[model samples]
Target chain A: MEGKIRQILKDHGRLSIDTTKLAVDSDLYQAGMTSHASVNVMLALEGVFDIEFPDRMLKRSVFESISAIQTAISELKTN
Target chain B: MTTEFSSKILYDDLVKFGHIIPVGVPGIFGRGAVFEEILNRFDAAVSRLAASDHATKVHFPPCINRQVLQKSMYIDSFPQLSGTVFSFTGNDAAHRELSSRLKDDKPWGDLQTMTDCCLTPAACYPVYPTFTGTLPPNGALVDVQNWVFRHEPSEEPTRMQAFRVHEYVRLGTTDVVVAWRDLWLQRGLKILLSLGLPVKAELASDPFFGRGGRMLAANQREQKLKFEVVCPVISSEKPTALCSFNYHQDKFGTIFNIKTSTGETADTACLGFGLERIVMALLKTHGMDPDSWPKPVREVLWA
Candidate 1:
């Protein structure tokens, strides 16, 4: 799941830095991922995981870092 | 002193005095002649105040190209507020069906297809597409006025669904853009102050949609990217934003391939004056009759 998330980030994150070197807890927005790019990332994640994010989970903290995204995906998958 | 009840009273008074004509729409209304005169005079006053800047003036239509709107990424942040154009492009048989549905009062929205253009969300949006290249040493400064549409409808007289904005856009290096925005923040306050309205300038954020949008809005506020000059036009507790100052740090430049003379992505800033809202503020402040307004305020606008 982590590897897949990284791949998705690399493909759609539009971050200024390489995802391979980014820490799991690093702030994606601080790394130059724009609000526009973040939406694409969310859509791609939903498509890959086959889980729809509820309105409550659609927040910045949920997508702030790779770890946060992983945790959100996990919660959705279990549900 | 202004409450929800007073707001309704104000709206009714404006309509009674023929300042605003209710066209049977909540947030849409036709302007009376006196209201139009005041609007035009206030618009000219703003232009006069910014005359020293000598910005290039441009007029844009109310709708922009759909592709440009998508590229600007407005839909991602404000899907709820965006308005897209739709039109009927069908054969004779389909037209007859559409006509029948319309005559029968059945839903006919499905018969229309989305057009290549959408209603312009902001007055400055169409300007970015025109700057898809490098700027001069001094960069670019534009003065634009156009009708902007947002989907929100309400009983608040100040919250119009369609309105005009007089906007000034500056595109250049980071320092230049930021400085321009900061300068305008002060100038905007002064412009409203000169009109004798109880105005205040404060940090603000766009009404981004959805749960994700709340985070984006908080981030925006934290960055202090937007500021609004607000006036108590309808409610004192919840003032209306008469003007806004926004600093877009290379967002449009990156999207539109705009560059500075130094080969760096250009930063952009804009200051917009809500024409109708300002007039509304003036009416609320000085009473509805323009001729009876204070001599100094009347001179500031009429002069």
Candidate 2:
């Protein structure tokens, strides 16, 4: 799931850092991902994981890091 | 996009032509004599076009009550773009600390507290809360010239952080408001074209927030709820939205509890013009020199 999330970030996220070097705990916003690009990431994640982000989870902080996003998807799937 | 005009060139020309006086900030600028003249001339042109339609004219400052912003849902949709006012509300000891910090050339803005009002996000925001109960048979029309603020700092001269918007809002049934909005969209194009601007009216949407906002924007475009008069200010390929016409089908009316004479929810629409953008577009299109413009255009503006 972490590897796939990194791949999704590479494909859809507009990060300034290299995808290979970006850790799961690294802040995406600090890596230069914009709010618009974050939306694209969310959409791509939905397509990949088959989980829609609830409106409450569509905030900037939710997509702050790869781990946070993975946790959000995991919690949504469990629920 | 492909364009000969750059921000540096535009900025220099604006200063040379006495159209704008740049402050230390990126997007905050003071209008010079010629720029103010152009704004007044454009306002007069709009007045002439709207002469037959009597709208109760009002003016608002750059600040609005915080409660008004909460009621308008501005915080929900565009919190990133919103600007709130802050002030120093401290005891004498805190003031002395602030003075010491200033003496040390340290940050002092953190000492201030958030005020009761935020910068006016839109010229029409304060108008909605003022309306209550039923409207007259033909409904109501209001003319507003207000200074609005948004935290969008850009290198483009047309995109200012603080500027004025001249708006005419209509409250009536869906058919009436939409028809009026549509009519004014054409009239607005004519008015700009008369000044020799190559204007194009296209369907557009606001910068809504989150995934739900994406759907709302799509729906707005699908229903043709918004239209903007775009002109090539900075780039010829990608023009700027200098003016906009919006048809809000009972959104504002429902929020403000405004109704038609029969007590049904009233539909609302507004035709708004960015006064600074018009000036910028005119300068960009017709060179920096206003005297060298076409004879008809000069007469329309100066007459």
Candidate 1 chain B has its poorest 10 consecutive residues by lDDT at B1-10
Which residue pairs in candidate 1 have backbone atoms (N, alpha carbon, C) closer than 3 angstroms, thus clashing? none
Against the true two-chain complex, what DockQ does each candidate achieve?
Answer: 0.27, 0.04
Q: Which stretches of candidate 1 lie over 4 Å from their true place?
A: A1-5, A23-27, A39-79, B1-5
Question: What TM-score does chain A of model 1 get?
Answer: 0.96
Q: What lDDT score goes with residue B228 in model 1?
A: 96
Error of 1 at B40 (Å): 1.1
Please, what are the lDDT tens digits per residue for candidate 2 over residues A17-57? 88889888899977977545677888899999999887667
Per-residue accuracy of model 1 over B1-303 as CA lDDT, tens digit each: 233436787898799889898888888999999999999999998899889999999998999999988988797778989999999999999999999999999999999999999999999999998999999999999999999999889888988899999999999999999988999899889878999998999999999886567666766776788999998877778889999999888899999999999899999999999999999889888887888889989989989
Clashing pairs in 2: none
Per-residue lDDT for A1-79 in model 1, tens only?
8888889889999999999999999999889888767777888999999988886666667888999999999999887
- Model 1 — TM-score against the truth? 0.89
lDDT of 2 by residue, B1-303 (tens): 124757677877898878888888878988888789889998888887898998998878889999888776777678878998899999999999999999999999999999999999889888887778889999999999888988889877887889988999999888889889989999999989999999999999898876846745665676688999999887778888989999888777867899999889899999899999998888888877777878989888877
